[model samples]
Target: MSLLERLNSDMKQAMKNKEKDKLTTIRMVKASLQNEAIKLGTKELSEETELTILSREVKQRKESLHEFDKAGRQDLVDKLRAELAIVELYLPKQLSEEELSEIVKETISEVGAKSKADMGKVMAAIMPKVKGKADGSLVNKFVQQHLS
Candidate 1:
C-alpha cells in the first residue's frame, strides 16, 4: 500500500485499539505529508519525496528528544521517545554501522576524497546512495573516519 493508504489503515486500527499516543503520531505524520504536498503544489508525492518528509519528521523528534533529555525533563523525554518510536516505524530499516562504514569508504574512493578537505565531495556523493537508510550524523562520522 502507498504510505497514505497504510497510514489511513493504521489510523483506523489505532482508533479501534484506543491507542492515543500512536494515533496522535500517525496524525502528525499525515498532516506533515499533506502540508508538504500543498507546499509543493502536487497532488501526490513520489516515494522518495515521502521518505524525505518522513526522515525530516524523525529528525525533528530525535533532536527534541536530545534536548529534553539534556534538560532533565523526564516526562517530555519519555513522551518524545515514544513518539520517536512510532515515527520510526515508518522509516526504512536503518543501516548497521559496519554497513554504513563500508558504504562511506567506497563512496570516498569513488569520489577521490582524500582528506578532511574532501568531506563535502564525499558527503555529496554518499548521501543520496544512503538517504532514508542511514542516519546523517552516523554517515558523517564514518566518512570522517574513512577520510582521515
Candidate 2:
C-alpha cells in the first residue's frame, strides 16, 4: 500500500480505538502530506518523500523533547516523547550501533574522507543510506569519531 493509504487506514483505527495522541499525530502527518502535494501541484507524494516528512517530524519531536528537558518542563518532555513514539511507528527498524559504525566506515572510505574538513562529503554520502533508519546526531558523532 502507498504511504497515504496506510496513513488513512491507521487514522481510522486510531479514531476507533480513541487513541487521541496517535490520532493527532496521524492527522498532522496527513495534513503535511496534503500540503506538500498542493505545493508541488501534484496529487500525491512518493514513498521516499513521505519517509522524509516522517523523519523530519520525528526529528522535530526529538529536538522539542531535548529543549523541554533542558528547561525542566517534564510535562512537555513526556508529551513529546509520546508523540515521538507515534511518529516512529512508520519508520523502518533502526540500525544497531555496530551496523551504524560499519556504514559510517564504508561511507568514509567511499568518500575518501580524511580529517574534519571532509565531514560534509562523508555526511552527504551517508545520509541517503541512513536517513530514517538512524539518528542524525549519532551518525554525526560517529563521523567525527572516525574522522578525528
Which number leads on TM-score? 1
Tens-digit lDDT string for candidate 2 (1-148): 8888888999999999999989998899889889988998999788788888888888888888989999999999998888888888888889999999999999999999889999999999999999789998999999999999
Once fitted onto the true fold, the runs of candidate 1 whose alpha carbons sit more than 4 angstroms away are none
Per-residue lDDT of 126 in model 2: 95
Least well predicted 10-residue stretch by lDDT in candidate 1: 105-114
Supply every candidate's count of residue pairs whose N, Cα or C atoms clash at under 3 angstroms. Answer: 0, 0
In order, the Cα lDDT scores of the candidates are 0.92, 0.91
- What candidate 2 gets wrong by more than 4 Å, as runs, is none
Model 2 scores a C-alpha lDDT of: 0.91
Highest-scoring model, lDDT: 1
104-144 in candidate 1: lDDT tens per residue? 98888888888999999989999999989998998988888
